[model samples]
Target: MSGLPDRTDVLVIGGGVIGTSAACRLAEAGVGTVLLESGALGSGTSGTTAGVVRTYFPGNPLISSLAVRSLAAYQEFAERTGTDLGLERIGLLVLFTDEQQVQDFRDTRAAQQAAGVDVELVTAAEAARINPLVDERTVLAAAWAPEAYACDPPAIVRGYAAAARQAGAVLRTETPVTGIDPDGLVHTPAGSIRADTVVCAAGPWAGTVAAMAGVHLPVTTYPVEMLLADAAGSAPRDALPMTMHPSSLRIRSWGDRILVGMGRPGPDETRDAWLQRVSHHLGTTFPALAGQGLEHGWSGNLDVSPDGMAFIGRDPSRPFVYAAGFSGQGICQAPAAGEIVHDLVLGKESWIDTAGLSTARCPGVPAGTA
Candidate 1:
């Protein structure tokens, strides 16, 4: 925290989607930028994401609104950059078994509609018609957002990292930040880098990284677990629409495989175990999935901000900026976060409000946890 061996206009911690987007935007703006990642690119939650980019979040107005913007940014950028990110506008089908939960979904869909998201509520009969596989008894109602989408997270992640690098941001792989200083000191295993501004986008490890800077962040990072099936011979032609279950579970198909995940899976189970549990649970819930076999299972830790949104903004007392604790939806919201950080760095007006997500709004430093 003492030495200033290297210098840059901005220093970004964490090379995940959020950090990569920030670096790309910052560098494109001509802000000398340096990005650091503890591991390989897109190896975190971003990698594990089924690439679902939907606007049917429970009732999160801020998140849903920003998701709309982020999704647009992704689509536009992918086209302009000529990156085959495998983005698909497959829509989303959020299922509800409980009547109250169904009502909640209806209300939330209405809210999303009001927020400019093309979301609609459908009856159980209509839902069954949409996806005959959906157990009619288990569904009370459903919401469909046709504009929602999914993509290959690896492509998106690599696209952004590559763009950031091509745009002039110096990127370091497997570069872990050992320490940070409010005034702009970043220590890594390889060397040190100094900057006038430091942005902490350390995904699930945001708390620990913030700690090195004498700051505490309120983020409970947990493992992102999912079950991936190769479809063996019954591979569905990606008709799944990033469906969600009453248990906050989500299922989608990637290539010839299917990936089942959770929007909120207790925050305790590892991906390895969650896959087994979810696969078994799916077997019980839907008899059709009785013999469904899981092929490859993977897990990654995703930082969850207490408020279920990303922690983005400048530290009130310290001269540092941060963007992490995205719960488990960072991949979809990465662009919005980057735009905000880019504007903040450039002294431009914010395109959206991010007050509630301020690291100062909540407390509980990501206390030295693994």
Candidate 2:
């Protein structure tokens, strides 16, 4: 990672899944691309993602489309990049206890089905059959997507980085971007890089990176916690699917271990209190797993937008494009985000409608801001 390039066609800041994927797409299109990462690839939020891949966004069409497209790319990842992402096509089961939630899901199911997503509303019995971990008595209905998957997040970052390298993108790990000028000069610890276009995909730190260029991105960072516990005694007979309850507790089987994720803890909550809350929900939802000892716990940040959507468009005043504010859906939506970045950088029309994902859509930002 020596001899910092003085100039390139594109400079991508961040080495997470989104940045690497954008670099891969740009380089594949014959653009001279340079990617800079402050730390090791995927060492950020991408490394700690729950890696649940599903196309059920309820009312968001943009996210649903991006997720579906990303899922397809992930399925063909090995064929295109010759890299294994550890993709497991274990279905997704979303359990709901409220009648209104069930009706909302039923309404959204039609649109999802029309969009080619294999999703359906099922009864409690049907949901239990798909994932026996759920307490059928407490569930009113569930949404089932047979094409959902759980993947290895770090492997995905590595796979995309390798593809970008092979496609002629210069990738430098540990090369932190220090400053950026509106005229396309990117300052780094090694040296400065000048490029015709730049992209900021720094995950949770994207707002900080964008501010370096004098642009304001309304991205908020929040922490998400997850735990892994041994489910040897109560493990389902068949491999369990990624299961979720309305309480924002997500559980999925990883061999003999169960990966459990809880919603963001309150600002006043301590780590121990958050873990206790997660454990309480886990035990209450599945009585069989009561008193299970957790093997590991970790936390990562999510860059969220006010509307809970991503910003994927060119900056109106800066000489750069940005892809951020994934709102915890980065892993499942990264491939599409990369493609959108490539299209915006090249001044080409994206295959999907990206009007709603622009930074201008954010509240308080002027219209046409991005």
Candidate 3:
């Protein structure tokens, strides 16, 4: 398209993975969809994600259910859309360092099992057998889910965008949304677009986008640093599951390199500082990778809610306005979120219950209508 159309059936804000997924679903449903992005596609948090797809949210049933559904979606993405996502089934190992943590894991495993998730509570030895790179002293027990996967994030985003474009979704990058009215008028520097419905899938900048529509969303963005380093020495090439530490640090194998990540509060962190911290943490936790030199490090923003659960569903006052606050887990649940947002826009009943994720359920958001 030469310029933004004067009007569209649905205007999707943001071109990250979530926005692209939503746009694809809407377009496939035969809606006139226009996706606007401030920067390049997947340049935000979606690009910087660890790309660990797992259904392991213990206490949050909504997230767990969505994750389970998304796992299936990702596994079938290439088959359904004929787009290669570079999906690798490396599995996920949630480590527990003590007896109490192990018991907690066991309880969570029970809940996950009842929800039809295939997870196994393994001993320290079993965990080591699954991934020998970890320090055995730190693992008392672990929850091993074999279906968890890791994928090429940028490729996945491109796949969604390509599919959306093929399905007749207009994608406009470098077009920032300056303003939005409750009645579906979207303002950009180029021109104004009048949409019948608007959906905001902005990742870390969701709060700012919500304010444009006069709705106050409680979304916080934090800086998260991650590093990529080559295997120290004689590291096994395969059969290593994506590992998570009790400290919330995650490490996964990326071919011959290791991907390490940790979330830090506030906005002040240098790349050098993050490298030092991550190197120390990985060395301390794994021991085998101690003193390994990090090859590269980068930082990205993570959108989070107060309760750590996603805020999804229609706005109370403006029913046509919908937002999805994925809170850093957007990739695994993008398809489900897009479908739910689509359903809400069309006033149809969603297969998945979304009452628990409504904006009204969030703090400081009033229940005007849902």
Candidate 4:
């Protein structure tokens, strides 16, 4: 049995990037905030992310807007806090193999350009010129978004946590939140923290934490596995854009080595099994990666909300809040998300309309989704 005690102004669950970020924003805005993680900071989806920053998406239009806004926010955050969290603007390279896909790429490119995205359509040869590793035969055409980038996710969360603490927010790692009492107490393995507002940013396990508060979020878990390639010894001369292969594989160069992500798997697979499936899939997809050897690999579970957008607002029926279910698209949106969540908690007006992210956006979700 662990000791649990009394209450704070706000308690946050799943101390990953989103939670840490909410804490940082709230604290900086003079709101009392405390964050509790089951393990270490950034130990979940935020830690092992490919850190691929992209402004190109076929479906979600909010993605393009958020990507651009978040990119600017990341740069400004780094300069403001002096947090060089390894954020890099390496651009994005989306290759096509067939005529149909090329047309599709063009359609997407046109959509991006219309949305004020700085992008270019390049020939396969031009793509090869940008990155010599890209073969002309395999790549028929490519969509290039020069504004896309990458970052070291775990380090970014750490930086946010540090800044949050310095601003008077309480961050407790290795301190798993057990539940959220209806009466405003955050029960944890270490103790109980009292708060008027509770935020759940548990990523894949977000539903689990919401259930602790008698909330049923229609979110399923899907994990993606990523492999780290052996360093090429010298720094990569060609700025490797985030490359998305037609086969659902994403290869990203991280300075010395490359991050080969098998991409997000479906919801049927268990949290642990997704990695194995992705690893096997990645090895089969990339013949070039066969003998070079895998330096390291990891899996991060993602929570897919019913609507595929995040739940980032206060509880309509209960006294709590949340920012979950980015569907693996959280990093690029974190900057604006943090600001929105802080304002929502304080009932302050926010420019970013969070109507689509309310817990009420989907019925039966946590009252906090309101």
Candidate 5:
């Protein structure tokens, strides 16, 4: 529908992966749902994600369990949503250069194992055997999770949107939410929607949206960049997994090309300087692909929290729930996020323990709240 409905059971703001996933699950459960997006579905940060789905969180059992659950959801995405996400179970290898990181990873691996993740800490030689692209001289050891996977982020968002529509949810694109009331009223340019429950999944704009409802969300935004280079048959790229280099560069296969992602640059760093740093890291880590087909580079923002973890629960005062501060892991964790939102909306007990993910964990939010 081009126009907004006067009322809904649930009004979801943001058409990214998390919002769409929540709408899908809610509508599937027979709730009257309406989703409004400021732009086309997945046009936001969700489309720009590296789309790596791995169940490996360093010593965080809550996040690790959520990752494992979401990985299973992605593996069964096509069967459930009737859309193939082109999931590539290429696996993931996190390389550590020094002994300190190795020891830290030992603890992380133990946490992951305890959380039921099939991951192992392997030697540098074994890492090279798994993927010859590894620079064994620099990498001391690696954590390998052969079940990790990657997929099309935009496709995943569209899949959930489509499933939500099929299940009787109303989704409107190019509809920007301008105001939100604590009593579950959402205002846009077209009209207003009064809902029993509202969801704030607006990615980086989540804090701004929550503030409109008189809620305090401590989510911050940071810029991230990624470059795509032609693999050029170097180092058997087909056998390569989503590899995390010791220099903090994330390397993965994007079809025949290689995707290299660098974290947020320094506050005063110039674009050229950031590119130079990426070039240096790529060349030093993988010598063969130093200057090969450096085709495309792009930037996006991440919704980060002070704790670097997501807040997924209802607000303590407002009638809206939220799933924000995903940092950069929203794509991999959307499925679990959707389930949590669904449970909150219906007042049902969530299977996953959400005490650590509540908004109360944010500074000044207080305990037993969001």
Candidate 6:
């Protein structure tokens, strides 16, 4: 009783943003919580994220609402913990390429407005004023969300971990979970942790971890790559907005550097070929970033579900097991997802409607749904 206990009320697997945030909330509520991470906190996908936080997700009310709540949580986290989240609310602009896409933007703007998101439809010229990177020659229109922010993912993860520790949660790094049982036994190289409940926030490895517990989760992993470059003459004078292009490429300002990201391409494409493609894309869209020499690059696996939305909630059959499938929005949804996990473990009413987000709602990996 004087030292770390062998048993805890909750055993959280994974030390990423989702796990640490849940641990923070659970410990703040006086639960005996233990969080185990195979590697350092935020060193996985959380570390490689683009770190864009916004409440506009086209037509999804659940994600938008959760994101709105999490933005407030992020601000509170920075204020209370004295942690600089590097939260630059420089806004987000998604450019449309054609009239049909512009109409889609109109519908999306309506949906976002219905969900209480502060979004507006801007002309191509106005979009250029916001980021000065839009290709006015081909742009049809744009959807702007001024409340969005770009943050430091590592700082956010560490902030949650620090708060969890201060609230009495025990966090152990390099303690890889070897196996898990339905009876609440977690096996690790360090030792066994007997828990009353287990929260799986393992990201890409969630499916593997679930199998050890005799459960199957329909989660898949894909490699997503990003590029970084110095903002000497390639970036705007002021902070640039997170710009999403129709080509699925996203570019933003990360301090004095430009961050570029896109979904993974085919295996035949080499890194040099990909960079050339990215350069061409930038030349066509921004023009300012054309031929800009990239200083760094990295890649990480994105844990995605069949429906593209996250699968959050406890398993109906295994009441003690909870899984949070972030689907690449972990940083934006982690704060609220953590609270939802806490509510599930404590048998309390969640702040938002989580009925539709259950894993049971997932259709289980359809043919080729990304």
What TM-score would each prediction reach against the true structure? 0.89, 0.96, 0.93, 0.84, 0.95, 0.93
Query: Model 4: residues >4 Å from true position, as ranges?
Result: 1-6, 99-116, 230-239, 264-291, 294-296, 306-308, 359-370
Once fitted onto the true fold, the runs of candidate 2 whose alpha carbons sit more than 4 angstroms away are 367-370
**Candidate 5 ranges with C-alpha deviation above 4 Å:** 237-239, 366-370
Question: Model 6 over residues 246-358: C-alpha lDDT tens digits?
Answer: 88888998778888887766689987787778778877888777777865578888888777788777766664555556778888888988989999998899888877777
Q: Against the hidden true structure, what lDDT does model 5 obtain? A: 0.84
How far in Å is the alpha carbon of 339 misplaced in model 2? Answer: 0.7
Residues 1-370 of candidate 3 have per-residue lDDT tens digits of 4878899999999898889988998999999999999999999989767887877775565687888888788777789877878777888888888789877766676677766678888888888888887777777888888877787788888998999999999999999999987677899988899998878888888888888887667778876767787786768878468898887788888777888877763348776776677778788778888888876467788788778777777776674555556777888788888888889888899987778887677666664231
- What are the per-residue Cα lDDT tens digits for candidate 2 across 1-370? 5878889999999899999999999999999999999999988878777787787676675688898998888777777667878777888888889999988886777677766578878999998778777778878888888887778888888889988999899999888889987678899889999989889899889989888877777888888877888885756766788888888888888777888888766789887787788888888777677788765667888888888888888877666788988888899889989999999998899987778888877667963332
Best candidate, TM-score-wise? 2
Candidate 5, 11-56: lDDT as tens digits: 9999999999999999999999999999899887897778887888
| Cα lDDT, all candidates | 0.76, 0.84, 0.80, 0.74, 0.84, 0.82
Tens-place lDDT per residue, model 4, 1-370, is 3443355687878788788888898999888787888998888878667786666665456667666777777788889989987867788887777899877666666566665578777899988776655666677888787877778787779888999999998777888777777787777668777888878788888878877876666668886667787644443566677877777777877666778776654668664475565555444434344445554577768888777777777667786676788888888778777878888888889866778767666665445531
| TM-score pick, better of 1 and 2 | 2
Worst 10 residues of 4 by lDDT: 282-291
State how far residue 341 of model 2 sits from its true place (Å): 0.6
Residue 238 error for model 5, in Å? 1.9
- Cand. 2 TM to true fold: 0.96
In terms of lDDT, the poorest run of 10 residues in model 5 is 361-370
Can you give the lDDT of residue 174 in candidate 2? 89
